[model samples]
Target: MNTENDNDEKSMTTGKAQRGPLRGMNPIVTLGSAALTLAAMALAITLPEVSLAWLTSLREALSPILATYYVALVGFFLVFVVWLGMGRYKNVRLGPDDEPPEFATFPWIAMLFAAGTGVGLLFWSIAEPITHFGGNPFSEEAGTPSAAIKSLSLSFFHWGLNGWAIFSVVGLSLAYFSFRRGLPLTIRSALYPLMGDRINGPIGHAVDIFAVVATVFGIATTLGLGASQMNTGLDWLFGIGVTSTTQLVIIAVVTVIATGSVVTGVNRGVRRLSEFNLGLSMVLLLVFLVAGPTVVLCAMLVQATGDYLDSLLAMSFWTGVSTDYQWQFDWTVFYWGWWISWAPFVGMFIARVSKGRTIREFVFGVLLVPSLITFVWIALLGGTALYMELTGTGTILEAVREDVAVALYQTIGTLPMPSEAIALTGGVATLLIAVYFITSADSGTLVITTIMAHGDPEPPRLQRVLWGLGVGALTAVLLVAGGVQVLQDAVITAGLPFSAVMLAMVVGMVRALRDERFAPVPGQKHRLAKEIWTGRDEVS
Candidate 1:
């Protein structure tokens, strides 16, 4: 009977393999995703101003809904992920109980930090705090001590638990369903509990397609931001003109490097780059801490963390319903939307590297560790800048307001270092940003190809290169068309529907966990009970 059941399962698997769409690819997903990507690119190129105008209009039209949904959804994710990590299901393993983790702790955490946030932290760590200090919708005064504190707290809030929660839930669902249930490692697998065998049907195809589109646009947005910042760094350091043409050239060069990394595979290429990123980030953080107001920065870190913790609930649910719409729309809503958009890509990459870990371990590692690192980074970088502004020693706020991309360089200039040291620091920073750009593009390439290859971890090298170049190209197009803001708006638009899919994923994961079929076998307790019962029966 057992043999027959095994044979039946094999037969079903073989049948699906034989009938799968487009030989190796899911036809619906491949075709649909390609069509949408191409259409978006064409729109951006042919009608640049019109396309941007429409995106702006859409944002304006959906401002209220976007604000409310993002606030509620991210807040719910934060609670749900924490509950999963700490509740009864904490012991559940993403794979078989006997399987050990694939990577060691340091590498795992390093990869998560590098791939999850990439260069965004480097770009915004100073700018965001300074911008918020200048004037935030939540605050009544500008450039005051209270505003400065609020700035750090709000910056931490944006980059902290809420963002990681988005990544955690998605990664948890994908890893659990794929590794434990022996399903394909794709976005559609998260729906298996609800769809069952129909996960191989049109519904499954749609889910994967949505993930592909979101991943592409999300990655493109990051690439666009990185290019702009890189351009700014070049301008500040070497007097290079920050033009669209120069930025496009930078994108092309980096894309080639990323393609090379993708060809080397994850273990050699992605892992090494991630480790390098971690090391360089540490050096930058250390320098900032040592050179700046170290004592004040430490105090600010403690106070800001406390403030963030105390106000987490209020800030999480604050939709700005009756307050300043533009402020909320620009900052909070935009951040939530951006994080959600990047969830599929970052979440999928994390799941791929996170096999053989327990649910609780994965959740905490993804949520807590990186988030704390982010807070410290913001404190060291942003806190130092805020202190400078308050003391009237630096004018970073003016630079940030004028061109946010150059905020990091401007802040570094204000440090009490010599001109030569400042120049060297700027050079190192540029190098770090470039490598981070390559890391993001390559990892994104791997994830996109895996989806396109129906969740094959080692997809074709050609496909990887294609997707890498495609991401770079899309970034260039958006940069020329409407610059970084357009890219931002585009990602938010893509993220709205994907957010709903993520909610469904949460429901499916919970439902699947409730089913006893997936639970661990009863071991020591059952054996002890049996031994006692047998002794009593024999005595009787």
Candidate 2:
């Protein structure tokens, strides 16, 4: 039976793994991404007013779209929570296994989780609170007690369960259907129950292309932010100017380091990077707790957690009263759309790395654990920054508003070691930033390659390199032109289609699961082939 199953898996692998139009096309995709990035940058520099105007126009167009979609997102998450519970309780397995493990059964899942989330979290841990301090457009009034509470609450809302819910649903749906049913792992596969074979053609191509573009921009944005932060650290520590030139050089150096990792592939490069990041992060957290204002920070954390719990529901569903429209439009709607746009790349990467895990495990692990860590961060780092600012220990928030990276540096200087500690922290943060960016970029490249190759994992190295360089070039262009806001505006716009795509995915998963005869039988050659094609075989 085992021999037969092995042959069956071989048969399925041969039948399904073939190059599609997107396979071996990374160079073209890279060049395309680079061109748009350069163009965006050029407009920002050569025609700043026009660039800003275009951004405004896009925002206006996006407002109505997000308003309509925000309601859908609420409904969408509720549906996801239901299905996630059902999938978990039922012990549903997508491909070959009768029962998947409660947690990620693969070692690489750790690498994926760490690499995908670490950099973004590090960047936002300090920066987002500062952004919030500027204003919570949703608050009853500017700079009120209510405003500060709302600001922190909304930040949690953005980074919490609902946000992860979007990612988990799309990711699990794709993995479940693909692995369980021998469908290709693409956006079109997510809609196969609806579209049938039509998904294998132009429509599928369009979905894949949209995902590719979004992933490219997402990675570029991270690279730029990370570089900018590193530049600020250098300027603060060594009196170097944090100019765009400095940012570009930082990016290039980081890219070189990342390229070496990409060459080693996931096991060596990605895994080591993730472990290093997590360890360094814990060290930083410990350092802050011991060396900074320990008591004040702890108190703020407890207060913030209590407040976040109290306001969680209101913040998540608040679409801004129609009468007050400003808060709804600026904060709630914009963030919803932004999360929607980021969902695809992040979701896809998660799904790819999450094989051998059950739905419930995936949901809680992805949704709950990340949120807990985020709250901790907000309580510690964010809480510390706030303490320093409020007590007049130093102008932390003011410095942040002026420049976020410098604010972090200045705040750190108030601690015991001063220069040595601050420099070391900055260096570690810079290293963490580079690892996360590369992890995200490399994972994206792997996913795109799989989508193009009809779901093959081992894509050509040349294709991977093309994606790496493409992401680098795009980041350089966007940095040079200082078009971060424009890119952000574009992200908001692109997110709407993905929201619809996720909706389609949920419907498809339900249909596929209910069609009982489609279920696989163990030790059967025919079933084994289906399992392999769908990436369900336990061996993989």
Instruction: Give TM-scores for every candidate, taking all chains together and pairing residue i with residue i.
Output: 0.93, 0.84
**lDDT by residue (tens digit), candidate 2, 1-540:** 686457435423432423653434433333444465567656766886776687778787767656656745754685566566555233455455654443333344455456446555666676676567657655556444445545566667766777777777777777775665555565566877777557655666566666666666666666776777777777776788978888878777777666666666665666677666666667778878887778877766666677777876666656545555555666567556656666666776676666656556667767777677677766677666665655567676777777766656666766666677777876765666666766666665566555544555565666666666756777777666544565556666656666767777877776665643333333222233433233344322
Summing lDDT over every window of 10 consecutive residues in candidate 2, give the lowest-scoring window.
Answer: 518-527
Give the TM-score comparing model 2 with the true structure, all chains together. Answer: 0.84
lDDT of 1: 0.85
RMSD of each: 5.6, 4.9
Runs in model 2 deviating more than 4 A are: 1-52, 86-90, 98-109, 112-116, 137-149, 322-330, 516-540
Q: All models: lDDT?
A: 0.85, 0.63
